[model samples]
Target: MGKIFTVLLVIVGFVYAKPEIVIEDPWVRAVPPTAKNTALFMVIKNVGDDPDTLIGVKTDISKMVSIHKTVNQNGVMKMVHVDKLTIPPNSKVELKPGGFHIMIMGLKRGLKIGENVKFTLIFEKSGRIILEAPVKMK
Candidate 1:
Protein backbone atom coordinates (compact mmCIF):
# COMPACT_ATOMS: atom_id res chain seq x y z
CA MET A 1 0.00 0.00 0.00
CA GLY A 2 2.83 2.43 0.78
CA LYS A 3 4.48 1.74 -2.55
CA ILE A 4 1.27 2.50 -4.39
CA PHE A 5 0.85 5.77 -2.48
CA THR A 6 4.38 6.84 -3.37
CA VAL A 7 3.79 6.21 -7.05
CA LEU A 8 0.58 8.17 -6.98
CA LEU A 9 2.28 11.09 -5.33
CA VAL A 10 5.02 11.17 -7.93
CA ILE A 11 2.53 11.12 -10.75
CA VAL A 12 0.53 13.93 -9.19
CA GLY A 13 3.62 16.02 -8.70
CA PHE A 14 4.63 15.69 -12.32
CA VAL A 15 1.18 16.40 -13.65
CA TYR A 16 0.53 19.51 -11.58
CA ALA A 17 3.99 20.89 -12.02
CA LYS A 18 3.86 24.54 -13.06
CA PRO A 19 4.92 24.14 -16.68
CA GLU A 20 8.71 24.15 -16.86
CA ILE A 21 9.75 27.05 -19.06
CA VAL A 22 13.42 27.27 -18.43
CA ILE A 23 15.59 29.86 -20.14
CA GLU A 24 18.46 27.55 -20.86
CA ASP A 25 21.92 29.02 -21.52
CA PRO A 26 20.63 32.56 -21.56
CA TRP A 27 23.24 35.07 -22.61
CA VAL A 28 23.73 38.39 -24.37
CA ARG A 29 26.68 38.89 -26.64
CA ALA A 30 29.23 41.61 -26.19
CA VAL A 31 28.38 44.74 -28.11
CA PRO A 32 29.70 48.24 -28.38
CA PRO A 33 28.78 50.49 -25.53
CA THR A 34 27.25 52.88 -28.02
CA ALA A 35 25.20 50.20 -29.69
CA LYS A 36 21.54 51.07 -29.72
CA ASN A 37 20.42 47.54 -30.39
CA THR A 38 21.20 44.17 -28.79
CA ALA A 39 19.83 40.68 -28.79
CA LEU A 40 19.14 37.96 -26.23
CA PHE A 41 19.22 34.21 -26.79
CA MET A 42 17.82 31.24 -24.93
CA VAL A 43 15.88 28.04 -25.23
CA ILE A 44 12.38 27.72 -23.81
CA LYS A 45 11.11 24.32 -22.85
CA ASN A 46 7.45 23.55 -22.37
CA VAL A 47 6.79 20.46 -20.34
CA GLY A 48 3.08 20.88 -20.07
CA ASP A 49 0.44 19.16 -22.08
CA ASP A 50 -1.11 22.37 -23.36
CA PRO A 51 0.57 24.71 -25.81
CA ASP A 52 1.81 28.14 -24.81
CA THR A 53 2.47 31.16 -26.96
CA LEU A 54 4.85 33.96 -26.07
CA ILE A 55 2.62 36.85 -26.90
CA GLY A 56 4.80 39.66 -25.66
CA VAL A 57 8.01 40.56 -23.86
CA LYS A 58 8.70 43.34 -21.39
CA THR A 59 11.97 44.59 -20.02
CA ASP A 60 13.09 47.68 -18.19
CA ILE A 61 16.56 47.75 -19.70
CA SER A 62 15.35 48.81 -23.13
CA LYS A 63 12.74 51.12 -24.54
CA MET A 64 11.77 48.85 -27.40
CA VAL A 65 11.28 45.11 -27.26
CA SER A 66 10.23 42.90 -30.11
CA ILE A 67 10.36 39.31 -31.21
CA HIS A 68 12.56 38.92 -34.24
CA LYS A 69 13.57 36.15 -36.59
CA THR A 70 16.53 36.06 -38.91
CA VAL A 71 15.85 34.49 -42.26
CA ASN A 72 17.84 34.01 -45.41
CA GLN A 73 16.25 35.86 -48.27
CA ASN A 74 17.95 35.42 -51.63
CA GLY A 75 21.22 34.57 -49.91
CA VAL A 76 20.96 37.68 -47.77
CA MET A 77 20.27 37.57 -44.08
CA LYS A 78 17.25 39.59 -43.04
CA MET A 79 15.71 40.17 -39.70
CA VAL A 80 11.97 40.43 -39.38
CA HIS A 81 9.93 41.55 -36.43
CA VAL A 82 7.25 39.24 -35.21
CA ASP A 83 4.23 39.58 -32.95
CA LYS A 84 4.30 36.29 -31.13
CA LEU A 85 6.28 33.05 -30.82
CA THR A 86 4.68 29.73 -30.17
CA ILE A 87 5.87 26.70 -28.19
CA PRO A 88 4.10 23.45 -28.69
CA PRO A 89 3.10 21.10 -25.91
CA ASN A 90 5.90 19.03 -24.44
CA SER A 91 8.30 20.58 -26.88
CA LYS A 92 11.14 23.04 -26.91
CA VAL A 93 11.77 26.24 -28.84
CA GLU A 94 15.24 27.69 -29.32
CA LEU A 95 16.00 31.40 -29.60
CA LYS A 96 19.60 31.49 -30.61
CA PRO A 97 21.88 34.34 -31.62
CA GLY A 98 21.42 33.97 -35.38
CA GLY A 99 17.94 32.53 -35.24
CA PHE A 100 14.89 33.73 -33.39
CA HIS A 101 15.94 36.33 -30.85
CA ILE A 102 14.62 39.15 -28.76
CA MET A 103 15.54 42.53 -30.15
CA ILE A 104 16.09 45.22 -27.57
CA MET A 105 16.50 48.64 -29.05
CA GLY A 106 17.14 52.07 -27.58
CA LEU A 107 19.02 50.97 -24.56
CA LYS A 108 18.67 53.07 -21.47
CA ARG A 109 22.30 52.32 -20.65
CA GLY A 110 24.97 49.87 -21.59
CA LEU A 111 24.18 46.56 -20.00
CA LYS A 112 27.05 45.64 -17.74
CA ILE A 113 28.23 42.08 -17.89
CA GLY A 114 27.24 39.99 -14.84
CA GLU A 115 24.20 42.12 -14.23
CA ASN A 116 20.89 40.39 -14.18
CA VAL A 117 18.17 41.51 -16.55
CA LYS A 118 14.62 40.64 -15.75
CA PHE A 119 12.02 39.99 -18.38
CA THR A 120 8.37 39.12 -18.18
CA LEU A 121 7.23 36.83 -20.95
CA ILE A 122 3.49 36.74 -21.45
CA PHE A 123 2.12 33.45 -22.64
CA GLU A 124 -1.26 32.53 -24.05
CA LYS A 125 -2.30 29.72 -21.72
CA SER A 126 0.45 29.73 -19.11
CA GLY A 127 -0.22 33.37 -18.23
CA ARG A 128 3.13 35.08 -17.50
CA ILE A 129 6.60 33.68 -17.05
CA ILE A 130 9.35 35.71 -15.47
CA LEU A 131 13.03 35.10 -16.17
CA GLU A 132 16.19 36.64 -14.81
CA ALA A 133 18.69 36.27 -17.60
CA PRO A 134 22.11 37.56 -16.80
CA VAL A 135 24.18 39.61 -19.23
CA LYS A 136 27.13 37.67 -20.54
CA MET A 137 29.87 38.57 -22.97
CA LYS A 138 29.18 35.68 -25.29
Candidate 2:
Protein backbone atom coordinates (compact mmCIF):
# COMPACT_ATOMS: atom_id res chain seq x y z
CA MET A 1 0.00 0.00 0.00
CA GLY A 2 2.82 2.37 0.80
CA LYS A 3 4.59 1.76 -2.53
CA ILE A 4 1.38 2.21 -4.48
CA PHE A 5 0.64 5.50 -2.79
CA THR A 6 4.15 6.84 -3.42
CA VAL A 7 4.00 5.87 -7.06
CA LEU A 8 0.67 7.55 -7.50
CA LEU A 9 1.91 10.75 -5.90
CA VAL A 10 4.96 10.84 -8.15
CA ILE A 11 2.88 10.36 -11.26
CA VAL A 12 0.52 13.12 -10.27
CA GLY A 13 3.31 15.57 -9.65
CA PHE A 14 4.96 14.83 -12.98
CA VAL A 15 1.76 15.21 -14.88
CA TYR A 16 1.04 18.63 -13.45
CA ALA A 17 4.43 20.17 -14.11
CA LYS A 18 4.57 22.26 -17.24
CA PRO A 19 7.60 23.54 -19.08
CA GLU A 20 9.27 26.64 -17.73
CA ILE A 21 9.28 29.52 -20.12
CA VAL A 22 10.90 32.83 -19.30
CA ILE A 23 10.55 36.06 -21.22
CA GLU A 24 12.96 38.84 -20.36
CA ASP A 25 13.20 42.54 -21.11
CA PRO A 26 10.24 42.81 -23.41
CA TRP A 27 9.79 46.31 -24.78
CA VAL A 28 8.70 48.17 -27.88
CA ARG A 29 10.33 51.36 -29.05
CA ALA A 30 7.95 54.21 -29.68
CA VAL A 31 8.09 55.49 -33.21
CA PRO A 32 7.10 58.84 -34.58
CA PRO A 33 3.38 59.20 -35.13
CA THR A 34 4.02 59.65 -38.82
CA ALA A 35 6.26 56.58 -39.15
CA LYS A 36 4.94 53.43 -40.66
CA ASN A 37 7.11 50.91 -38.83
CA THR A 38 8.67 49.99 -35.49
CA ALA A 39 10.17 47.00 -33.69
CA LEU A 40 10.03 44.89 -30.55
CA PHE A 41 12.80 43.21 -28.57
CA MET A 42 12.97 40.48 -25.97
CA VAL A 43 14.76 37.38 -24.80
CA ILE A 44 12.98 34.06 -24.68
CA LYS A 45 14.43 31.43 -22.38
CA ASN A 46 13.29 27.84 -22.66
CA VAL A 47 14.09 25.68 -19.70
CA GLY A 48 12.80 22.42 -21.10
CA ASP A 49 14.83 19.61 -22.53
CA ASP A 50 13.60 20.04 -26.10
CA PRO A 51 14.09 22.79 -28.61
CA ASP A 52 11.43 25.18 -29.85
CA THR A 53 10.93 27.17 -32.99
CA LEU A 54 9.25 30.55 -33.07
CA ILE A 55 7.16 30.18 -36.20
CA GLY A 56 4.72 33.06 -36.24
CA VAL A 57 3.65 36.31 -34.58
CA LYS A 58 0.31 38.14 -34.41
CA THR A 59 -0.60 41.67 -33.42
CA ASP A 60 -3.51 43.90 -34.30
CA ILE A 61 -1.58 47.16 -34.38
CA SER A 62 0.47 46.26 -37.45
CA LYS A 63 -0.87 45.52 -40.86
CA MET A 64 1.87 42.95 -41.27
CA VAL A 65 3.96 40.89 -38.85
CA SER A 66 7.34 39.45 -39.71
CA ILE A 67 10.52 38.12 -38.18
CA HIS A 68 13.44 40.23 -39.27
CA LYS A 69 17.21 40.09 -38.87
CA THR A 70 19.56 42.94 -39.45
CA VAL A 71 22.62 42.65 -41.61
CA ASN A 72 25.29 45.02 -42.79
CA GLN A 73 25.80 45.18 -46.51
CA ASN A 74 28.75 47.42 -47.25
CA GLY A 75 28.13 49.33 -44.02
CA VAL A 76 24.44 49.78 -44.76
CA MET A 77 21.85 48.27 -42.46
CA LYS A 78 19.35 45.99 -44.14
CA MET A 79 16.54 43.86 -42.83
CA VAL A 80 15.85 40.35 -44.06
CA HIS A 81 13.13 37.86 -43.41
CA VAL A 82 13.82 34.87 -41.24
CA ASP A 83 12.40 31.45 -41.96
CA LYS A 84 12.21 30.62 -38.28
CA LEU A 85 13.94 31.49 -35.04
CA THR A 86 15.18 28.66 -32.89
CA ILE A 87 15.28 28.41 -29.13
CA PRO A 88 17.54 25.57 -28.15
CA PRO A 89 17.10 23.30 -25.20
CA ASN A 90 17.74 25.13 -21.94
CA SER A 91 18.85 28.19 -23.86
CA LYS A 92 17.80 31.76 -24.45
CA VAL A 93 17.28 33.52 -27.75
CA GLU A 94 17.55 37.28 -27.73
CA LEU A 95 15.82 39.71 -30.04
CA LYS A 96 17.62 42.98 -29.53
CA PRO A 97 17.89 46.30 -31.26
CA GLY A 98 20.08 46.18 -34.39
CA GLY A 99 19.77 42.40 -34.34
CA PHE A 100 16.85 40.07 -34.66
CA HIS A 101 13.47 41.74 -34.07
CA ILE A 102 9.75 41.63 -34.61
CA MET A 103 9.04 44.08 -37.36
CA ILE A 104 5.67 45.78 -37.15
CA MET A 105 5.06 47.39 -40.48
CA GLY A 106 2.27 49.52 -41.87
CA LEU A 107 1.25 50.68 -38.44
CA LYS A 108 -2.48 50.98 -38.14
CA ARG A 109 -2.32 53.19 -35.08
CA GLY A 110 0.20 55.24 -33.21
CA LEU A 111 1.81 53.60 -30.19
CA LYS A 112 2.21 55.82 -27.16
CA ILE A 113 4.34 55.40 -24.08
CA GLY A 114 2.95 53.39 -21.15
CA GLU A 115 0.72 51.42 -23.47
CA ASN A 116 0.99 47.70 -24.07
CA VAL A 117 0.98 45.74 -27.27
CA LYS A 118 -0.12 42.17 -26.95
CA PHE A 119 1.54 39.63 -29.18
CA THR A 120 0.91 35.98 -29.69
CA LEU A 121 4.05 34.05 -30.55
CA ILE A 122 3.60 30.53 -31.86
CA PHE A 123 6.21 27.90 -31.16
CA GLU A 124 6.75 24.56 -32.80
CA LYS A 125 7.42 22.46 -29.71
CA SER A 126 6.08 24.22 -26.65
CA GLY A 127 2.99 25.62 -28.44
CA ARG A 128 2.05 29.28 -28.17
CA ILE A 129 3.48 31.97 -25.91
CA ILE A 130 1.91 35.38 -25.47
CA LEU A 131 3.96 38.49 -24.83
CA GLU A 132 2.97 41.94 -23.66
CA ALA A 133 5.47 44.49 -24.89
CA PRO A 134 5.24 47.89 -23.32
CA VAL A 135 5.88 50.92 -25.45
CA LYS A 136 8.56 53.24 -24.13
CA MET A 137 10.23 56.38 -25.28
CA LYS A 138 13.66 55.57 -26.58
Top-TM-score candidate index: 2
Index of the highest-lDDT prediction: 2
Count of clashes, each model: 0, 0
lDDT of each: 0.84, 0.87
lDDT (Cα, tens digit) per residue for candidate 2, span 1-138: 999999999888667644456789899989889999999889988887566788989899999989999988999999999979988778898998889999989999999998999998888866788889999886
Q: Model 2, residue 56: displacement in angstroms?
A: 0.2
Candidate 1: where is the Cα deviation over 4 Å?
1-20
What digit string (tens of lDDT, one per residue) describes model 1 on residues 21-78? 6558777655789998998889988887666788988899889899999998999999
Evaluate residue 14 in candidate 1 and report its C-alpha lDDT on the 0 to 100 scale. 66
| Candidate 1 to truth, TM | 0.82
Task: List the candidate 2 regions with Cα displacement exceeding 4 Å.
Answer: 1-20
